[model samples]
Target: MTAMPTRGAGERLWIGTFLVLGSLTAFGPLAIDLYLPAMPDLARVLGTSDSLAQLTISTCLVGLAVGQLVAGPLSDRVGRRWPLLIGVILFTITSVLCALSTSIWVLLVLRLLQGLCGAAGVVIARAIVRDMFEGHRTAKAFSHLMLITGVAPIVAPLLGGQILRFTDWRGLFVGLGAISVLILLGCVLVLRETHPPHLRQRGGAAGTFLSLRGLLADPVFRGYLIIGGLQSASLFTYISMSSFVLRQEYGVSPQGFSLVFAVNAVGLVLGSQVNGALVSRFGPERLLTVQLVMMCVAAAGVVGAALADAGLVVLLVPLWIVMVGMGGMGANTTALALIPYGHAAGSASALIGTSQFLVGAAVAPLASLVGTDSRVMGATIALATVLSLVALWRVHHARRTTPAHSEPLTTTT
Candidate 1:
């Protein structure tokens, strides 16, 4: 009997895994943003209140949360390939239903299904990364994957905006169905099974929950998780509320708003790419420290801008700076947190995504409370900054208390 080649085999596995999985992960942002431009129009057509119409988005979030639970463990049990294929097929079906929806409630249910479908891509993508790389390499690889996923927000809305010009918001769903089908085909042709069946039998759901408890009990993981969750919430809050903020408060049109949205998203790619280059030399811990501080500075600036009644451009400049740092923090934080766990990648991935979405879902209501101004949005930004900084400290504290012989940083998680 021949044992598998370890080091040489591992890197090759990682490279192949991320290439396909990264595209799947990118679909999450695409699903969320693809029809965003038509939200107002969709609400009017469906004869629903704007708030109720927005429930479609919320439904999707709920679905993603629910689906992650299913996909994470299922991946562990049956391997990654089948569950992902099924998810894509469901995503494709529901997307068609969404395009045909006549009422907000109908769309809501379909949106939930869409979210569940999308969740598989993200949860499995992370699990695959953990399958191959940990420590610095894990963090670095996350950055690269983040780079791949980051493209969705940039291109999706633009594409959606153009489509809305020709057809009703329903057309966006049609396009999504088409995109999902194409993506599914790409994955079928290219994506290999990364979570081999034999590698994960002993550590079933019970084992996964236990591993999760251990990670949760650790302050370093808690801090990183909190920062990750809060930062995600902060961005979701902005995206959710941007239309009202611009149209009502700043007096921008919907078309104009999409451009603004695209511009802000540019910061995502910028921050992510820079983080990729910097993490190797600086390390995630050190890089996060600086990024956290800058995020706070940006938050403080946003608050001051709202208070001082500064122009939108003035406030957004600081925000751009903050997101640039956030791009780096996003990947580094996950890698650092996961680096210690090898046996529970699926559960870990599930927990992290669930936490991020829950926090984001909770924070989304702030848009309603704050009522279309810089006020609540600014508070959300500050909240993310404060939490991320605290998380960095907790991670640092943990490093001091526990020191043990560990695997290669490349295989830490």
Candidate 2:
């Protein structure tokens, strides 16, 4: 129960710690994006309907949503390292199972398990950052992590497309399993326990529920969670529809679609890098306000281009701008939400992550429901952006009326 000494900045350990945490954080995106290019091929090979193949993605997201809910509080009780390690190990095992599945049903089950285990990394990494730093330092750390983790989405689809060129869709899962093993090694060697035994939550399920309820009762946390979830939906909506719209609608090849996806991901990376620089100077709340407005404008542009039936160049420009806005919004909202809950960072992070993936899971399937075209994609992005703007406005209003000393520190900004 003794306090662990904080590691000083500028040490080799700091760099290694961030890299390992970043790698862990990247696993969810890698799992989702890497297999996207293979969706059609997967359907064809597994003898399932396209809807069912798409369920593979949806089910995995469901698992991720549920897993974070479970893992977050559990990590708060048990500390970070063991739960994370177990999660990675389970993820690796389930990924291998996904590769070996002979039926789409079997693959669906394994994908769910894979996502559940993978949630440990995604949720715990955020908690670890909160454990390590506070205030603007937390925002800076998150932005840096986004910069490191953003590379996964950029590379994953391209790698998946290349893997498809030689092998089948099943090979994609095998590759994910392999990459997870490397992450497992890094977790064991580089990740230290950030949540100490003394700080760990007790009273079991009652305590966990109380922790979650307390977070939910906080208007500031709720606002940030809504904004983050809705903003994230814009990205997920694009992810769910992109392969279909680019390949089926526009006749872009799989390789070409991967390149397109990577270009947008680069926009995300750039935004995260910019946010890292600006967060300390501008503050997360101000940065979030600016980015949400830009996102609204960019999303409106997307709607216009879609309605006009504009070409790829026209469509991608607005979408890239939206991605940049998302990158900025994500770090700030997360940092703001967790600022008050250092004691239960895992549980708070879990709530934020669960909200995001749940929104994403809901939106992903709706792409098909609404019909897959640029217009549908644009409309979905616009809707999510509008919701985000509403949440941001609520936060602004709440901050204005609430007295300075009564509110959480970050909300005042």
lDDT of 2 by residue, 73-111 (tens): 999999988899999999999998998999999999988
Q: For candidate 2, give the lDDT.
A: 0.85
Candidate 1 residue lDDT tens string, 1-413 = 22223222565434545667777887677788888889999999999999998778778888888788778777777777788889888999999999888888888888988999888988887877777764667777788887567777778877898998899898899999998898888778767676665676465677656766876787767877898898888888787777777788888887788677777767877787788777667777778788889889888898788788888888788877877877888888787767666556776787788888888888777655766578778778888789778767766666677574222232222
Q: Rate the local accuracy (lDDT) of all candidates.
A: 0.77, 0.85
Q: Which parts of model 2 have CA positions greater than 4 angstroms off?
A: 1-13, 37-47, 164-170, 244-256, 309-311, 401-413
Model 1, position 384: C-alpha lDDT score: 75
Please tell me which predicted candidate would have the highest TM-score against the true structure.
Answer: 2
Model 1 CA deviation exceeding 4 Å by range? 1-19, 44-47, 100-103, 203-205, 244-247, 252-256, 403-413
In model 1, pairs of residues that clash are 134-410
Worst 10 residues of 1 by lDDT: 404-413
What TM-score does candidate 2 get on C-alpha atoms?
0.90
